[model samples]
Target: MISYEEVQKHVSADDCWVIIKGRVYDVTNFIALHPGGRQAILSHAGKEVTELFSMLHPSDALENLPPEACLGLVDPNTVPAQENVLTESDLQRRAAREIMPPAQSMMLLRDFEEWAQRVLSETAWAYYRSASDEEHTFMENQDAFRRYFFRPRVLVRDMSTGSTETTFMGIETSMPVFISPAAMAKLGHPLGEVNLTRAAGDWDIVQAISSNASCSVDEIFEASSEDQPLIFQLYLNKDRSQSETLIRKVEKLGARAIMFTVDTSWDSKRTLDSRAKAPTSADASSATVATLPVNRAISGYQDRNLTWDDIAFIRKNTKLPIIVKGIQSLEDVEMCVSHGVEGVVISNHGGRQADYAPAPIDILYEIRALRPELFEKTEIMIDGGIRCGADVVKAIALGAKAVGLGRPFLYANGTHGEEGVRRVMEILHEEITNTMRNIGANTIEQLKPEMVGPAGPWVGANRPPYIKQ
Candidate 1:
């Protein structure tokens, strides 16, 4: 067995070593290959990373490491016990968690956000809440939803028989809403994407697994039932072979569809996430090490040079339906249909990629006006600033096959884990049912365009004269 002192000698970037789950690993070679960048590994080099690793990674994270990288297990008796020291922030979070209102009291999607804001760590909250630049698109996403008002047709049909069930790319889902792919769920809760998987199974809803999830795809798949329909959201790697390998693996593991995210070709400025401090280091020399923003650190491996031609590579690898997510314009939607993509998600990366990007709802409206026929050719879906069941109804009325919500579910899972996720689904189900009943629609297909319209005369009004200046 190696002593702890032996690991300390290899702390530099050129010769990094760390202990994980009581085993010594020479991670120098893996540093450059790490998806979270070299600093993410270098910051914790020469230390036992069981606690941190458990929080951010799956149990099998190190299984793929070359056998030669495993020097040996450390002497159990010589290694120091990890202390459960609580910082002031930890105490505050604990107090907030303790006083959290009962689950039954959560009446709306926004309730979970409040609870998460109270209980999550500062860094976790920052990462989930921050949008690109001034967050104009983030606010606009919600505002755009409000621009549409329901044209309720009362007493026209039996409202009590309404159902939210719908098919996504031929897969039946209990609701038209699917959990949008969000990265690093472990930052919100220990179980991470597993919580989402379990809840999705229980609620009979579709869960889109993120490429950058805290849990491994294997782990998330294991948590799901034999027939649970799951979608894999991909962030293509710079290495073509790696992406091909992943596509084949997910297909083999039973992913019903592949949603390739294209909007994040380049990282955007998220000031709030940048301002949050990186995890503190136990090493004394950490003062001299360079740190990266939370968003930039985790996204270093993304292929920024992605182009329309690359879609063929994904189509070549998997027989599953391919979805082009992050389409911001009607023209792009047309292109996706021309390329024979099965579906497209009109999204602005939840307003986290571009500051003034058009909201998904606005894009949906644009399609309705310019190229309504595209909806017939391809399955159109949308996500961004969705907080209620009415929002889902509005999008469906405007011709979206389904709708997606990212931050709401992240907040729900962060606050209460699997239970929180389930509650959010329950609330949305009730709201969607009520909204459908109110609008005189009994099925997902019954939501017609005439049932909804712009909020008022100012629906497409130009900016005020003072603001134009």
Candidate 2:
């Protein structure tokens, strides 16, 4: 058994050793291959990293390392007791949590975001809230939804039996809204994506598991019921064999579909996240200001050469339905249909990848106007800037099969864990039903394009003439 003193001697980047859950590992060789960057591991070299490791990775993540890396267990007696010193941010977060409103008081989806901003750490808040560059697309995403107005058919019929139930890629769901895949959920809460899984299973809604999730596929699946449908969102690895292994693993684990994210060929400039100090550093001002942003650090291994031809590679590996996510333009949507893609999520990566990318709602409008037939050719879904149940109703009216949400759920889960997520779902379900009832639609099929129209005369312009003045 290695002593704690022995571990401390090998702390340099050239020779790194760390203790994870009492087991010692010499991770010198694996540092270069680490997807989250070498600095992420080097920061805590020669230290016990159980707490930090558990936050960002599953228990079995170290299994991927070579056998030689396992230098056996460290002597428990030799290890010193860890100090429980809290930072100023930690004190502020704790203080905020004490005075925060109860979960039931959060009636709206945006309400959760307001609380999350107050409770989350600077790094976590920045990571979830930041958008690319000037965040033009980010702000525009929500603004675009305001461009349309619902035309309610009053006194048509007494509608108390309206249902939000719908099928996504042939799987039945409680509502048209599904939780969109987001990375590193543990940053928000300790249980992370597992909180989402259990909540989704309980509520009978779909949950798309992220490739960069803090929980393992086995853990997320185990948290779900046997028949609960789950989708796997993939970021293709540069090493083809690694992705192949992952595809086979998820298929065996009962993932019903694969959402291949295709927009992020390279990382974008998220100024907020970049400006926030890295959590791994003790002295953020000196140690981490110049380090890579969280997005780039975790996404380094994602294949930058990803193309349309790579779709075939995924098709050959699994029988699961392929849904191309991050389709931004009509031409790309047509290409997806031609390729026989089972579905497509019209998204701009939640406005986190491209600075000025068009909002998903606007793209949905373009598709409806130009190639309406494509709606029937493949399942059309949308995400980005969706905040309320009315937004869900509007998207359905414009031909979206279902809607997906990322940041709202992230904020909800961040603030209140599983209960926060369930509350958001509950609020959305109520909102969708209310909107449907008011609009004289009793079923998902009744929502039509005619029910919605462009808002006023200044529909597509950046701002109204009066605002410019």
Candidate 3:
């Protein structure tokens, strides 16, 4: 058994040892390799960091650390009580328990978000909420949805026949919505991606699991039934072989599709997440901070050399339908078509990758205007700031075969576990049903372009004519 004193002796940067759940981890070699950065783990070196570690990481994260890193368990008699070790998480957990509403009362997607922010630890909240530098594109994603106005048809006959049911990439779904892939679900709940996949299966929807999911792909697949459709998102590493192995594994596991992400060549400067990692007060500059908490998955195995040739390699290697996510340029969409990609998820990495990037909906509009015929060939999808049912409707009307919702589902899982996710799907289903009736559409196919038009602040606004000053 290890002792606190033994752990303390290794606190310097060169030989850091951290205590997590009464066990010691020699993270000296791992500090620089940590995705969150070195200081995040270093700050908790030699401390009883079980609670902090649980809050910020998944169960598998500890397992992923080198086996040799596990020095030994600390003697329980010598350590403080488990309750004392969990002081921070205990407080947050209690607050969450106090504020959470009954599942039935959560009527809208935004309600889940409000509850999640209230209950999640401050750092977790910041990590989930933070966007790229200046956050302009993040704001734009939500605002762009509001700019489009829907034209509701009056005196519709046989509204009961309206169906929200649709198929995405030939996978039957209750609605035209799918869960967009996001990383680190453990920050929301212990079950993490397990909870998400289970909820998606229960509701007959698709879930695109992130490569950096707190839970591994095998674990997530185990939680799901054989018939449940799953998609896998990938971030290519420096080693092409690693990506190839992952592709082969997911295909073997029956993942219906592969979303090859390409927008993030470099990590973003997310101020809120960085500030969350900083010492609480300016005077506490000397405080131990084991990690420099950057946005999770912002800067990791992403290959800078990712290009069309790699895409071709992936396509040739896997029979699974390939969807190129984060396509914003007309040229890229044209290229995707030329390469015969099965699909394209028009996205900007939820505005997490780049500042001032065009919102996915705006990009969808541009693509529709330029090459409407491409939508017929490729299964087009969009995700970013899709908060409610109307947003989904707008995307479908604008030629998206499906609309992906990321943050709402994550917040749902955070606020109330698996049940929260179930409620979110239920809410979206209701909203979509209501919206289809209002728009006089009986099916997803009935949602035509003429049913929506530009609205709100930018309706008729254009660049002001410049005069010589």
Q: In every candidate, how many clashes are there?
A: 0, 0, 11
Please state every model's RMSD to the true fold in angstroms. 4.2, 4.0, 4.7
lDDT of each prediction vs. the true structure?
0.88, 0.90, 0.82
Candidate 3 Cα errors over 4 Å, as ranges: 32-36, 56-58, 61-67, 80-96, 287-290, 296-298, 456-469
Query: Each model's TM-score, in the order given?
Result: 0.94, 0.93, 0.90
Pairwise TM-score winner, candidates 1 and 3: 1
User: What's model 2's lDDT at 414?
Assistant: 94
Candidate 1 displacement at residue 205 in angstroms:
1.0
Clashes of 1: 0
The lowest-lDDT stretch of 10 consecutive residues in candidate 1 is: 460-469
170: Cα error in model 3, Å: 2.1
Task: Return whichever of 2 and 3 wins on lDDT.
Answer: 2
**lDDT by residue (tens digit), candidate 3, 220-243:** 999998789999998887878988
Look at candidate 1 and tell me the lDDT of residue 56.
72
The sequence of per-residue lDDT tens digits that candidate 2 reaches over residues 24-81 is 9999999998878888888789999998788778767888899999999999999999
